[model samples]
Target chain A: MAGHSAGTEIERLIQLLSRLPGLGPRSARRAALQLLGKKETLMRPLADALQDAADHVLTCTTCGNLDTTDPCSICADGRRDKGVICVVEQVADLWALERAGANSGQYHVLGGTLSALDGVGPDDLNISGLVTRVSGSDVREVVLALNATVDGQATAHYITDQLEGSGANVSQVAHGVPVGGELDYLDDGTLAAAMKARRPF
Target chain B: MAGHSAGTEIERLIQLLSRLPGLGPRSARRAALQLLGKKETLMRPLADALQDAADHVLTCTTCGNLDTTDPCSICADGRRDKGVICVVEQVADLWALERAGANSGQYHVLGGTLSALDGVGPDDLNISGLVTRVSGSDVREVVLALNATVDGQATAHYITDQLEGSGANVSQVAHGVPVGGELDYLDDGTLAAAMKARRPF
Candidate 1:
């Protein structure tokens, strides 16, 4: 259905808005009209904010985290333990980890995991940047905090191969029943892994 | 669990984005990060589009539909039946009707229905403009095509009361079971209304 007869400008806004991750064509129009309805309070500020973010935000040189600075706030912060680097698949994953207060160490955002099906090789990710950071630093440990997907495992194995001679020890996050998870809903693979890694009470 | 440490610009974008319909805190962050990651292809274009719309689009004094011109394209179109005006609650509803090719008549956007709880009354809507249009022209019918909600019906009734002596006929959209809808899922009120309004089909 042609739901785009408002005007060229509004239609254009809707088209662009639909490209946003969580928005579809229908919700985009709703958002566009809402913005137009509250032009001074919403539309103008959103436009300005988008432009400002586009211009200021940059990828960190040390880590792959996104911020308004070159090295990013986390990388530049002296309080974080630079000797223990926590690796993540994406900047969002890094943010999730940080929000959980999971680690006091610095982060290394991989940008993406390797996937042969998608033709995303090691070069496509921030692997070289990660290797360089680990090689130069006095890193005691390099934590591989990747997801449990096949691509994540493949990428982790590749990274381990790349850092074979590096001084830092590599370790992956433990797999088990989640903190609030029910035993009845536990999958076979998780049950086996958690059982294997069981410690004495 | 503060998940907004990307920087002020990203944080601000997330805050603004969350305000849009169909978006919440988590989804807004995902959208903001997506925009940042594709600045040239997505972010820049969206920013430009929003600015262009804000600068060019204006509310049509003739009908209340937002457009780049004083008289909206729909209202200015000579092909449409100006004698028959379809009155709707909002510009979005007008667009929906136009897309469906439901009516070839002109439209008058009321902006909203009367909501006594929220203090919305006839004066809050574009009722006087509608009255003036009906009075001045040889308009055969003024279709009160508002939604089927309590407020919508109340507003329609109020407008009918206001246009008592006007020459033009006043009518509302038909209320019945929606096409392709199941009988089991139909509400009692709608079923009764549809049965009452049943015609020789």
Candidate 2:
């Protein structure tokens, strides 16, 4: 398939594009053609953007977030509550929380959840950094904004144990029916959790 | 959503990626993070590929196919049958045909189909170039391998009209129930076309 491509450069572009999360080989070729057709408007700009991101974007030392700044914009923002830190599985989760305006606190990206089959441990993650942040600072609460998966729960529990003596209170986000989520379509576990964690109107 | 991003470079990358055919804003962000996470392996190579494509790729002067060479690889290929030319609406279509190994002939990309609503006319397409190729070369047949859309058929008819004096056989690819397609799931128009164009059992 690659050999039949118009040019090696274009083929290489498609190959690299297919490596992206949502794109496959077929769609990658389509994307390559689209980029070729709109060279100035889409292709060049995307090229410039990718190059720029490659050159500038860095991991935030403070919160393990990807940013241009060493501490990241969230960590640098003085307006955000310094006393609260939202723990998440990845930078995307951090961005999701920010997009939702769900919290006015800082974020701590754990990179990924603890996976036993994958052999990911506390050392593999940014757990020590998170513990140091909670222990060194006057942080009042460390909120686990991790997903409701088994690995996510296990990771949260591990972090909670690590932050046991750190003065900061460890709390997990609630597991229940999502906003606008239908009860009928939801899983039995979610329905059961929602029932048990029912709040007063 | 853009404003809440960690860095401007990452934000711009996400924005550019979201403009690709299949990706939305959310997936674009996820792609950006994936790129950031695997900077050396994925991000840098993709950037290099894009820049290389931008710097090198050129449209084939003869058939409107995109390649680093002006004539394109297919047009330059001595092994391919120059006697037949497959006409397609876009370079992607040409790639698809090549991927399928559907033909051993040369190709002529039309860039896009004729669209009255979009104000796409003959002047906007490579119809004249195709005519010139057929008239000048020993081309025996010009195959219209366009989509089944109304715009595609309109473009094919328009091209057929323009090739009146070119002395080349103008034929369109057959439209029928696709291979492995079930009659129960096939649309009415496709079923009707399949029935009308029934071949020897």
Candidate 3:
């Protein structure tokens, strides 16, 4: 309770910061203290920028990526190869693929995977929009870059079935252990997945 | 460049987030992405809290600890033993001591330790204010909870000298390896501190 105060807004800020992944109450307290130390240098600009982003960052109508414009940079660029569209779960994943210097064509953000337990389905996703884009356009291939979770695979299969006989090749990207999340902490399900996808199999 | 965007506001927020201790570009990106994903759930409350903290939280008049009121909670609490004041460089250090449940007295926040290289001196610190508090009150002891840095030791000495003729007993906290900072990464000074303060000398 480093920065905790009765009805103090800094306390609330610390609470919110603590809720973030990888940030505990101690980390949140340190962060809040740092902000207080340099209010002009850090806090003011942060607040203004957050407000600006909240007010202005409208998601791209077609791709669902956060953008100032309606179509996003990838969708608007005429020079980019439009025949192939890469479908990703989140805009951050799309950006990661771009950072890797691969996939220069286009993107379709699925919003999230189809988690039946979470009540997430194809209709709940941006898949219907993706289907529309694939069926109405001269697209040659749809690359599925979804994660390798059971829900992710189910979503991929569902999308593939939707694209069947639509004159567009449907292929799912490989599923494997993440470069981050620790292998030791992985449960039995992921261990089985790793074993099945082992090399030379 | 994980979260960098064309917008000046977006770039500024990402830059500020990245500058936080223990938060590099990767962590900052992950945090920003999380914020974007749950904008309404996280951002609104966070923004309001930040604004309110920035506008209201002020430095304590007595101890330099940040607080909504002038004297801060410790200084304000009448039940707290004011005869023994625990002096610490940062409010974080004060909170750490509080978490350990060792000291039950009041606290005095120094803001930072004396550093000649950084042009910080006793005058720059809350030293004179501390001396004033000691002089005016019936305080019997002032415990130094400063970090075991070179500057920390120097500031402790300086404070000891100031309280020498004031009838207040001054004591420095014991030194040891940090709770988290690895031994391999510790500087020579910290290593010497750990060795010199070894048990059973």
Candidate 4:
């Protein structure tokens, strides 16, 4: 495998594919083989798609969403509720929320959380843009849909502090036992949060 | 996600990535986000590598191995023992054997096994080319390093029959307990095979 018996081009393809988030070396090799086996059907189209994305996909100036347009489809759409903006850590989280259909409002991507260990500060993220979007606008509610991680909470708190008197009500997505999640398999923190947040049903 | 919130190019990239062997829709989205995040470093290089592979990689005429050249580096090399030909089902198997340093001899890729149910026949494989290479040559042995599956063995038997009286000894890789296999977790058929093929050590 090191000597690349399949040739340099195939080896390079496998190496690049292995760098993807979920693909390992073995699966990358298999993927390369499949691509080579069906060049016209899979490989060519995939190459074209990658090229197209690289050339066209851009970050939205308003929401920080990745799209072919500057404002993105979500920002450009008139049907979405502009008054309530769901703030997420990344475009992936926004896509997840959209897929789940949990929000009918607009979205604001922060790019990433404030990570001190990695030397990632507020300036490294799109926090300033979010504050600017929230201030002097029709946006009445800003929902923090960030992850439950420490950095995510810290970033949310920082954003909340930044939007203190912007005349927009700040809120956070509920943190409790996930729907359909087994309590036996849940962590102590989640169990405590679920207990504390219990409502009168 | 269905409406291509990230735009058509990003959605197309994710769709193509999901079609790969090991990636599903969720992982594809993650991979696409990673690519978008690192457009210059990862996405562009991957696109270039894939395009290069699609344009240059050709099927080796001698052994059916994928390579940039016709005869392939293996066939072109003068140091390899041409007298012993290791036959495998596909280029992947040939690569596996090469990676393990299992064979110093030449190779013959059969493309695929003889699958009657799938309507694959002898003519569909590169069996005739292997026979032609073995006949009227100084070849001493033809090793069938095919899978231990039913179709693989059937193809091996058919090849053994076809290569009869061709001045070459036909053999198959042994099937038994793997080198690092545990006895307790061994299957009945494997344990039986190991017992039947016991050596006087």
Kindly list the interface RMSD, in angstroms, of each predicted candidate in the order they appear: 1.6, 1.5, 2.5, 1.3
Candidate 1, after superposition: displacement of residue B101 in Å?
A: 1.2
* Model 3: lDDT to the true structure: 0.80
Cα RMSD of all models vs. native, in order, equals: 1.7, 1.8, 5.4, 1.6
Q: Distance from true position, residue B53, model 2, in Å?
A: 0.7
Query: Candidate 3's residue-wise lDDT over A60-113, tens digit each?
Result: 888887766677767887888899989999877876887785787888999899
Candidates 1 onward: DockQ, in order: 0.71, 0.72, 0.36, 0.75
- In model 1, residue pairs whose N, Cα or C atoms come closer than 3 Å (at least 3 residues apart or on different chains), thus clashing, are none
What CAPRI class is candidate 4? medium
Candidate 2 chain B, which ten residues in sequence have the lowest lDDT sum?
A: B1-10
- Tens digit of per-residue lDDT, candidate 4, span B1-201: 334577878888889999998899999999999998899999999999888999999999988888999999999889999999999998889889989989999999998999999999999999999999999999999999999889999999999999999999999999898999999999998899899989999
Stretches of candidate 3 exceeding 4 Å from the true structure: A3-7, A116-119, A148-151, A172-201, B2-9, B99-102, B115-120, B173-201
lDDT of 1 by residue, A1-201 (tens): 225447888888998999888899889988988999999999999999999999999998888888899889888888889899999998888888888889899999898899999999999998998899888679989999999889999999999999988889999999888999998898998898899999898
How does model 4 fare in lDDT? 0.91
- The models' CA-based lDDT, in order, is 0.89, 0.89, 0.80, 0.91
**Candidate 2 local lDDT, A1-201, one digit each (tens):** 455757888888988999898999988988888888888999889888888998998888999888898888889998999999999998888888888899899999998999999999999999999988989789999999999999999999999999998999998899999999999999999999999999999
The number of the candidate with the highest lDDT is: 4
Off by over 4 Å in 2: A2-5
What's the TM-score of chain B for every model shown?
A: 0.96, 0.95, 0.82, 0.97
**Model 3: DockQ vs. true structure:** 0.36
CA shift of A187, model 1, Å: 3.6
If you score just chain A, what TM-score does every candidate get? 0.94, 0.96, 0.84, 0.96
